[model samples]
Target chain A: MSAESITLEELDATERFLLAIADDEFVTGQRFAEWVTVGPTMEEDNVLSSLAQDEMGHARLWYELIDHGRDLDTVGYNRRPSERRNSILLETEHTDFGDTIVINFLYDTAETLVLEAVAETADDAVGSRATKVLEEERYHLEHATQWLERLVSTDEGRRRVTASFERLLPRSADLFAFDAAVGTAPSTAGILSRPTDELRAAWRETVEETISSLPLEVSADALEAAVSEPVTNGRAGEHTDALTALLDSIHAEGLPADHPASGYHA
Target chain B: MKLEERIAAGQLIESGDELTDEYRELLCGIIQFTANSEFMGAFAESEWIPRAPSYQRKLALIAKNQDEIGHAQMQYQLAEDLGRDREQMLTSLLAGENGFGNAFHYPADEWIDIGLLAWMLDGAAMQLQHSLMKTSYGPYARIMKRVCREEEFHIRHGEHIVREYATGSREKQERLQAGVDRWWSRAVMFFGLSDSRSEKSERMDELGIKPKTNDELRQQYFDTYVPKLRNYGIDIPDENLYYDEETEQWEYTPPDWEEFNRIVTEGGPETQARLDRRRTAFEETAWVRDALEAYDGTTANRFANNITA
Candidate 1:
């Protein structure tokens, strides 16, 4: 339904659902942008840079849909960690290029799946937005897939990337664990029709299948261990200290009082 | 027509074979320096991406620095097409055996320095690059066209930030002033030596690689930026700086060439630090590149990968 056609409950649920997606994109983009000028090669650096900016652009699009009267920068940078809604998988510090690659794969894969769910069941406005976001996400997945193959081709690359997968994949259990955030309101309001568990299962299958092709081994047992762990999630605004540090660092320089981006922190 | 005849007729040289050895050497040097500068420049300011004052600022900073890297990629490819090796250029850059702009050799001490970098340094580069859009080499001129287009955004973004700071609180204005004081001399010498003191300008002008002499570009940079900074209530570092109405020239205290040569030939404050960062990153990621090379560069191999997501 269009904005005029949709009931208030639907609008509220839709905004809640998309806010989580936007937060994920924004945080992921911030992490990705950290790769600027430091990627393995100039070509790869260019690609990562493009990916970073694309994510920020995606975040802005989602924010625009739900910001009410706030500007993008306010909605993006001014949110406290406790208020943010993103997977804990994405909030970790990127200590290696391998970490970036693994997270890129996991994040883009989960995003594509969930966005597909949104596109399939959401109102026309959101469905079209999801469709648009997926168009850009298609390249991101391709990048992830190609890099995963090449990175795993070597012993060192495989070991390092596997280590990243072990650490990061477990955190990804929170991707579809959004029930605590909006509490099935989106699903109930029909803003999202796919059952959460079904989405989680599909995501795990795709990720496992992708890893199965490579020589590298990620402990599937560990991923499942985290998945079934009770309420270990970021969707309910429970984030790791990593997100706290990220917020502090970004706000460290301190925006000027009159600066347009200066939020409550100012 | 002969290469010289084509150049003399103001024609673009599209092919490498049409060049004399001197022309090729000069063109190669110019392109190499340009490509190296882009990479190094991006490196110098790249760390600020995550720490930018705001989300919009962060995005803008990333796009700006990212453009420098993209320009490097394009220019390196252009250099390769002109008989230079991209890998060797990068290797030399990390090895401390290459030349790039003087501005990048220094650190951006404060966030305000980033503003000055994009505002003044990029502004100065754009002055020279806008002129290079008319360069005699076809590939380089074409690259400059796209490069200048993107550079316009950097300068505009910088100007916006600088304007805000200029109109902002007392503390913000003071920081902006300090950044200008630190960067002003470097920006002045950004054009390198004046035509009379430089050996390469006349030759470059003769070959049409760089049509504008050092003084000309510097003058243009001064004309645009001097008033802008002063209007913003920031101080210019040089007291002797003035426009010569009689001679139709901008005059300023010339940068200490001895200091310029020392920093350029020896190294600047951040030269070793930034280069080490690149070297370490390059060494660490050598495996990824080596692995791809093993498969004949399957890094971007589209359909050949086994993963299906």
Candidate 2:
């Protein structure tokens, strides 16, 4: 069988890759959406809301690429928290606007590197979906960087932004630690052009470049601390208390069991 | 022709035109009121985003909230152009000195309540805003043109749930009915005082700011929702509600006027809680705003609502 032909190992690699990226997006989208009504300004609220929708839509797009024989709702919303593979960074509760900007900046930077790998290496479906996500993700990076610049430019803003980076950056190590297969198996299967460790390194450099330009106090030592990874590998289905709580609200009980995906009316 | 004469002739009011203070003030007032309503409504409905039963429902609800917030942005921009700052408007809302659409002050206790909110209550608001698409205020009419289009989708989002539950298992039907009962009176009071008492709206109708009177809009709401709810076997909760064939009006027992006045002035069950939510959020993020202001080399924003200051 040729590389492009069907292979169990390749399919396993692909599914793992997609689930990791899609779960990251899905969880991040939910966290971003919680900012909808109460951002620092109305304009930022709208922008953050749009970004949330984009991430969720991206999640749905990636979920659609899976052949799990489950409906999109089940794939996207019904999975147990123990089954989800999102980074703990994405799952953590946003403590402040500083957390919002820092997480967005950190997450989107890593997302760009990962998506670019899929876009560069994978063919057919994965490549096309990655391409589409990368386009929407361009603006997300801009939104993050723009906010970071503004927030880091003030004394109080800089203090909070720096503190948020200190607290959240270490958790972001999970971004590249989705699966042990992540480091070499996906690229060998021709699914990603580069391995996870290489992408993780690039991710740090890109994030460093962005933060260095700003007046943020995040240090090289702290960046190296973020490199110490996989204390809780998200791909292993271990999660924080936040993910469990998020699942309870999202896949809520008391909804009619017979409710349809188009809503029960359909 | 003078502004009044042009207004009488159904001329569309545009910005930058010389106008009587009354027309301008009235225009600014309604615009501010609407902007506040959209802002408050978006905030109220957003709690359901995490709780929507399906992923599609969740996304649709978020999109609906986004539209409301977008509408608030446009409305606030128009309000700002008319003389008030958007920051002041937001500060006023948080301060609770400004009143918004009364329906949002109540709590949506269940997903069913959110369903009623979008279907029944938003359906009620669509009646008034739809007519405002033809309002004599050109800027407002244009905004309403887009607002009503989005609102139509919101009502359908609501109706989808309403129909599902109303026609579902017995327990489902009971929950739907319960939600209808809770929201019905609030939806009715959304139109405000009746024709005789609503002198302010009468002036608005004359000025073409509100092209329909409160009673007329209330009747429109009844005409649209009554039969649909009845068909779904959801009770209207107003036993006194009936169409008077001879007068061609919805003749019903009005909602408790004293309660209406109290909710309007002092606010409803969730008003303080929701406002406190906003107040806490605002205070929590003051550093973000200050940082932006400082970075932009501007003084810290002094939002100047009389009540806020």
The candidate that achieves the highest TM-score relative to the unseen native structure: 2
The per-prediction tally of clashing pairs is 0, 0
Least well predicted 10-residue stretch by lDDT in candidate 1 chain B: B300-309
Q: What is candidate 1's lDDT per residue for B1-309, written digit by digit as tens? A: 888778889989996456788888898888888888888988988878877877778888888888999898888888777777767778898898888999999988677888889999989888888999999999899999999999989999988889878888998898889889999999988888777845677778888899888888999998898989989998898999889999989889889988888887888999999999999988877877766765555434321223322
lDDT of each: 0.82, 0.81
* Per-residue alpha-carbon lDDT of candidate 1 for residues A65-114, written as tens digits (9 for 90 to 100): 98776666667777777778898988999888889889998999889988
Q: Residue B44 lDDT in model 2?
A: 93
Docking quality level of the chain pair in candidate 1: acceptable
Model 1 achieves a DockQ score of 0.43
Candidate 2, A18-52: lDDT as tens digits: 87788899999888889998878777777878988
